[model samples]
Target chain A: MTRVHDMGGRYGDGPVRPEPQGVPAFAADWHPRALALTVAAGGLGKWNIDMARHAREALAPRDYNRFAYYEKWIAALADMLVSEGLVSRAELTDGQGAAPGPEGPAAGPVTVQKVRQMIANGAPADRAASAPARFVPGDRVRTRRPAANLFVDGGHTRLPQYAAGAEGRVLRVHGSHVLPDRSAHKLGEGAEPLYAVAFAASALWARPEHPRDEVVLDLWQSYLEAV
Target chain B: MPHDHSDHDHPHALLPPDPALRVKALETILTRKGLIEPAALDEIIDTYQNRIGPQNGAQVVARAWTDPAFRADLLRDATAVVADMGFYGRQGEHIVAVENTPEQHNMVVCTLCSCYPWPLLGIPPGWYKSDAYRARAVREPRRVLSEFGVELPEDTAVRVWDSTAEVRYLVVPMRPAGTEAMDAAALARLVTRDSMIGTGLVTAP
Candidate 1:
């Protein structure tokens, strides 16, 4: 299903307001804390990044549209904490803990030093290529259309609705990486060969504003089929 | 009206608690549960707010413009080159440097989520994460560029990179003219965050 967050080529939102250079990273005091808490809690490792993304995407469309950027992060983080048995909804709502925490190998005290090290050494997503890449640069391909039964609510996808089923040319091949479709659902990593596909703006939109322009998307191989 | 003993200064209290209060409550709960550390939170905040940002990207851009070999390395394998320069981290696990030339222009966007090169450019600007940019950039990039005060020639092809996967993109904007005598640091000062995002161009100062 095309979730509300999959907003590409849709219109009438508003004009872009470029903030002045050197604007503070957080607009308000809570913004940074929200971001930091989300990152820190994520280190608990109960859920992966894709699962966290799914939690956010699962927000009701109205709520997703209403919440500010960090608000979504905070909301999703709270949901994950409760659902993962790390915290309780009562704890979140009442501003106090009501039960004992889960027993496990203590995941963290993710210290400041540890965070700094984590930042320097990022969580690399590239996994060993399960098989040879099915396509290469200069190959013609088309993104697969979502099957009617496929991608219902909670089915996460990296393929935006705008480029679905659209024909494009492969610009480059990025080796296997974790596919969100499977990872978000608690399925295996299901790494796949990713590609940079270039589609003509005219092809993506029926009414061409700039026919000479192009829209390039980095898509996993599963999302595409040989044209 | 019945005299109630709840803390209701005004009718606005009928609404949900302020996000600040909500967040503070979450922090308190998480800390109590030992799921997170406040000090680590402080570190994450400080690192993004102060240490990493567009200056890193500007320095990379400056180096690329002044050093052809470095520029070639950047365009060829941005991940290794930038890591060699010590700018590798989360949100920037894999990097691709798409150069903006006279013939073509490149812009980056993530419609699904706000995926940016945080190690290089820090947090994305508010405008980049806005609904309008995510919706309109790929469909009408020329118009979006114009809104950002960039008036590209009609002949120049605009390439909009929708970051749908793990790979993050950085636009290596063309070096401005009349700066041949300036050093890399001086040129770095002229590179704006938007230029590296493909919304604005570097102007010779």
Candidate 2:
């Protein structure tokens, strides 16, 4: 159940590295193509962002440390293309295999205008929340550990390990959105009320150094229980 | 993108690991299938390369520093307010601006994954996506901040926002002393990506 991607509060990897002040967005020629392939495939409107994330995290845990950031994107893109029947494994491996097209107009050679429109109008994650809002702002809540049936392999989650079983106060109620835990699994994504729960530094770690500090996590209603 | 393919790497490492060749192969395959338009790819690339980035976030922070009503508006509805200024979408759809004051300072991190406001901040810096950062940012933020040369008063409460859902946070850092004469544009220049991320501070002029 412990996916290597969920790296909250784990120690001993290495020191936090310094970032270059101005690394170009596309550091290499492949970088732009990697971004394009993923973005273009996404334009098909077949999968949500959660599924894309799962595909990335789905990489072998051993490979997590080895692959570069965009490398992960390429790997995931290849997997998604093949598994979704958009491309075949042979095409991905040797660039020779062909894939079947869906009915109607194929969303290819995405137009420049379409790109601008998509960027201008951000993908609002506000789904149609069905249930009434459960907890309001200022309510005490704790993050529930991943429920048993949440995932088959127990791979991906927005819920970090540090906040599990930890208590915090609801700072604000972010209107209901698709709960990613379910969405990643292609399961039912019943929109639910989400809250910004704030926990003291002492609550998350043992014998905290910065007691004055706190962490606020945006937790969905299902991941929380009243304290 | 530097490829670090060690001779001691795993079996999968032996595949077409050259980034350029690999991407080219993928692109060729997609093009053959009519799945990707190079024009669309150019727009996407140009957007991240030239159009939007952290400067957009700095402008927002600068406006908040100089304009009171806009600050209130930003705190109330940052997504719409930020969108009003023409910076909205993607990783920045729902923004919640947490102000840094003498009492409390705010920092943003996504512990589970790297969920940054790409529309505002463009792509996150390399460090922000590191496994070390994703793990340590929450456990020892002060140390991490210090490592980045950011020092806060011991009394000031540090609030780290682990952006877990669609909502993204922008840290409205306190303006440095003796900057009252400066205009929004000048103040905006003083703002750094790290300051907004709360790992570093805006230095006093």
Candidate 3:
């Protein structure tokens, strides 16, 4: 019997590969399958021509409300994936499960690249270590206008268009890099940690008067600055 | 095809009107009549809700509840803290948090969209997100509460929070009647979800 572990964890196409015969090597392996699953779970199954038409119609002016409605459909796609077994419940719930144990039935080594790919591929994205947070609770900060995509809907996606670059304070540090729950269903790899970030109001607005007028946002680490 | 009210929720009913057509309608009526331009209306909507909405109320309530010396702070700096929380996104800059006291209770509504205080309170509840709650929250708030099985004393003042623009509102319900003896988590439980929206108050059960 030839040992496959000698290849340094890379999925090589050699005859000696033993056990777990059909696993794909890169994160993009199951893209189509995953997308199909997402679409199905997002309530797009059976293709409601009328509903689609309405949603398309609603998007003519690109208002946030239309986007919110679209999110429901996207969420339905994620739900379909979970039901169909293309995505596992463990994967969905373990966006922060880096505790060095059995990851799953197909447990294998995880890499930072894999983590990034999971996020890009629509899994939930937690906090990233590349950009560590500087401010803590009691520290004041301002929201900066960073360039990013703002989805107006409320499904498995990133920050709402209405909340991009909004500012606040650090209410609590939910450990290290965790997934941002908002996009976790679409971007997570089933077991990783995403960071949690909080922002305040006075930091974002000008001359206003309430003290507790503070708002707390659970942001990914990638969405922060020192100020 | 007879118009059947019973079969109204046939999935097709949920479909919304087209945006371009709605925009055209507004343009023809408002812009042509010199009432407003498309860009101007967009800017106005954005500014009203984002720069001056719910964050305004939260700041006022938070300040007053936290500091005895800041009643003036509550009134004057509503949106300032909203800025602090970076609540200045697309439609949520102008914000406010309302306080519900022993003498008064506060509730919020958005005659349009489910506009809410996303920065502070997270997402709005399913009930608040429903049209029934929004439509009745302002007009017959007391009656709606009765439907939810919540009855208030006749003498208690009721304040309804109507959110226009992106100015959302949160009810800082007076700390529960006996909540002074409780901890934060304990207080949190007593802070029923409905109480935060001003539809109900926390009771020590």
Candidate 4:
């Protein structure tokens, strides 16, 4: 159940190409518009950030790979609008209004002034820590191994496939924060203590290309166990 | 094995290839539904395109390079220190400033999604979000750094920070030599976006 979006440590994707000098923030004129649309629609308070990510991740593998970056945003935003009952598929396809949209508890349409305020006051995910952190810096820990089913229910997770079950040392303790695994599934924030775990290069890959190199991941308390 | 094309029942195949047209249609429909405001969309685009960007990150790096106290504060409590500079916003709610010394080099990547510090660095660059980078940066950082024309010393340890949680990281690159006399503005100009991301290094002008 490892989705294509969880692409860490897999091979043969291709070479990295840096954008040309002084390239604009966006390549195409429509790119910024696509980003703006997604932001504005998201401001309606219909879904949280985790749900937005889940919508994009839920795309079919073929479509996920085939669509360009902003194209994926546009596609996912379209599907969310329809599925959330904000708009109808017919309205989108025909470019016409079929009926008056449902008046749910949506924060009214975002105005220009609100856009500046919202962008400055971006959504903060850090929640109040209910209990003391389980691990501390310098403590040895291991990431949780996925069960045999491997999340067939398609719950959203921040744990990449490469880091699963790897032994590492805690580098720092970042207080409680929302766990995306539950947030994406309409579950509660499930706030938990997060840690910065450092795994040596040799521990992750079969061959030690750079023995001293290391990879650090911000893992939740639930994802780690004392080793 | 090649992808089987026989099963062409993908629902999204009906989507128009021209994204501009699709976006326009979607916007029109959403406006009619009173779900989104066009002016708000304009403001969102303008803010990221014109106001927020790498210059903000460069300013922070410049201040850190010139002021010892500021640098220490950045490494110890980046969230508060950075917000004091008016660089607080989404994707940067919890910030960690990792400094690069002669012994250790730090790099940032989000293997899960494009989780970048938008308020400080604006939108992520195209290559930063590419599948190749997401897949290889964690496994083969040395090779990835070399591809970006950055080669570290043999003994320098490379630490790749993968953004798995909400906590975002900003790499405080080592200041280049022969720039002690330069002012903060000049020093800021020397700090590129890639340098702060740890893919490239600052060079003296």
Candidate 5:
């Protein structure tokens, strides 16, 4: 049997204690500018897939430092969401009337789940219905020409410092979607379904490579072209 | 010293949601967004369908426990060998292996996002995606672990890994007592999904 210990008290050695007030207090007008930037850039969900992919790849267990960057970025996004009137202060304070747990008012609202629910229940359809795929399944296609200057989203871009302008067969087709590589407008690759094209190892790298080894890449539809 | 076993059952009691349903819910949400790129989703479905899960990790761990040579290979280069089993791609190309001993414990968390070794461990458990766990695990690992029935002594430094790009980590849990004579298959059965993720340690039946 594992003996459960009360280790909560040990975590308070630093200035990490939860505020005594049931809710975090700040001047109502003290809005986070980073979030306002996201709103100005566009809705938070506009950056969803890129963010998820970043979180999944760059924020693994060993990369604590990078994960901290994501956390800060996400927090900034959240603050922007609230200030933009996309999410109300009351919604964050009281979860549209759900039972409050011991955590506090912000616990329910500030979570990604909460923001997602808000998106589900309310985010406007700026571009939800557009058709973005340039190719169909089974099409022989290749990656479009790489942009001369690399454009990153919020932070440092993780798109291979190499590996752009690669070509592959369109094993399957996805709809039009936002290109991870920021376009001329500087907005995220907007509302589009990305594609997963499988490239043969021999094609991606020249020298000697096993023909059987293949690399499958998830690319926005806009990134592909007819082979 | 004789120990009371009450805590063990309670922690294990918080079973996770059905994987298919959870995936379904997520898929439904993405699909509605018109974001479900069928081709990409198919690859995700295929990768998850064919490989990636606890069963795959258990096989590797069990093989390592029994074979010194395989253990060396796993420790030397997990990503390549795991990819050799056809499980490597963008997220799992880099790998680091951590061993779990009776005295010293280890657990994995992204704290930022769900950076999991999906090629090896299959899909991550639902709790790994929970905001409560994600926020609290790095800040209060021992406490969060105790809630999961993993009690490490204060002296044992529980390294909470924050998985990121360029590196990945997996836990090689210590074999339970009285399991030395057990076959690899039997030992494999003892390897729980949580143990592989470093959320909970495994015990023999």
Candidate 6:
């Protein structure tokens, strides 16, 4: 949905801050734990990564930008854990909630060795190549909104606001990918061919001196149409 | 859009934002329930911070700089080329390396979220996750690049790669001039994480 998180082309936030040479990944002690818990819980295979993303997108638009990256992660992790019955609200508040007690599916008790292997193997989303890609590189195409309403709907979407209508050429056709839109809502992946659509910066904005500059957006088959 | 409007959640803004107490609370609950092991959690964090990071990608870029065959392989099939070099994992299983020449400059941004190639670049830098960068990088890339002190010539066509899928991008920045004599090991030292991210250039030594 068109929330603060989808802040492409929009402005007024601030200048890009220079990241110092060597900053620690986790600022606070909890930051690492927050990231670790989210990844570990997400490893359970209960909800797709897309679904977990909505947990943050579902937050108030104001809160979305205010929370730090890992903070949003922790929020999403907590929301998923509680709503999925992995932990109870009382338990979250009390910090001593009883386990689900073998009633429903548990997400994880991920071992160190398993995480190492998973990190090595990686969670690749590439599915088998499907029907011949409709649009090959050099094919002119336009991105379609498709969704009825972006913000109120509160689901997953890769279509950024900046490049939705702006025309472009397909730079390359990435093989079939798990359609994040459907996967985010618990719908089956129904993998489809994805393409990297390139739109000229001149077309995207009213700026000058960028006739040759372009932005390449990775789009799902459904998000595009032959132009 | 029914949300958790329960009394239990009322202390949200006053409490949920607190990284300290909330994490302690969560650790207490998840550990008591036998979900997460502290050691395993730290291991994942350590891997990204130390073992897997820009140094790995720097090595790849360095090798490509010195070896024409490896460079060709990287451009053709970065996934296999990078994997063959032993850099494969989360946020980086499938990657496409876009080459930047004097005529073309490539930049990377997730736009949707901070979807960086963690296994290659370690954790994403803070600016990468900033609201200003995500919003403007795709819109005014030249301006964004300038903000990062990357002044490109007007003739250079800037290509901003919006990482919308699981397939992450690593910009094979043009090797700086006056480094022809440098070997792969020394060249690796020159590749900063920002250079690979396309936000900064690999300045001459």
| Proportion of true contacts reproduced by candidate 1 | 0.65
- Candidate 2 per-residue lDDT over residues B1-205, each given as its tens digit: 2221221222223337786777777777777676666688888888887887889999999999999999999999998898889888777888888899999988888876789888778888888888888888887888888888788888988888888888989998889998999999999989888888888788767
Among incorrect, acceptable, medium and high, the docking class of model 3 is incorrect
Segments of candidate 4 deviating more than 4 angstroms = A20-24, A98-107, A147-152, B1-17
Residue-level lDDT tens digits of model 3 in B1-205 = 2221211212211222442332232223222322222343333323333443333334434345545656444344545555554544322334455666656566665533355654444334445544456444543556566766667666555555544222445567675455456554444444544555666655675
**lDDT per residue as tens, model 4, B1-205:** 2221212323333446688887877787777666677788888887887888888889999999999999989999998999999999867888999999999999999987788888778888999999999888999988889899999999999999999888889999999999989999999888888887889889887
Scored against the native two-chain complex, candidate 6 gets a DockQ of 0.54
Measured over the true interface residues after superposition, the C-alpha RMSD of each candidate is 8.5, 6.5, 26.2, 5.1, 20.9, 3.6
TM-score of each: 0.93, 0.92, 0.35, 0.93, 0.44, 0.93
The DockQ of predicted model 5 stands at 0.03
Of candidates 6 and 3, the better by lDDT: 6
lDDT of 3: 0.38
Q: Each predicted complex: what DockQ?
A: 0.38, 0.42, 0.02, 0.48, 0.03, 0.54
Against the reference, the lDDT scores of all candidates come to 0.83, 0.77, 0.38, 0.82, 0.47, 0.78
Top candidate on DockQ is: 6
Using TM-score as the measure, name the better of candidate 1 and candidate 5: 1
Q: List runs of model 1 lying over 4 Å from the truth.
A: A98-106, A147-153, B1-16
* C-alpha-based local distance difference test score of model 1: 0.83
RMSD to the hidden true structure, all candidates: 6.5, 4.9, 23.5, 4.0, 19.7, 3.0
Report candidate 4's fraction of native contacts. 0.62
CAPRI tier for the interface of model 4:
acceptable
iRMS of candidate 4, Å: 5.1
Model 5: runs farther than 4 Å from truth? A1-227, B1-43, B46-51
Error of 3 at B36 (Å): 33
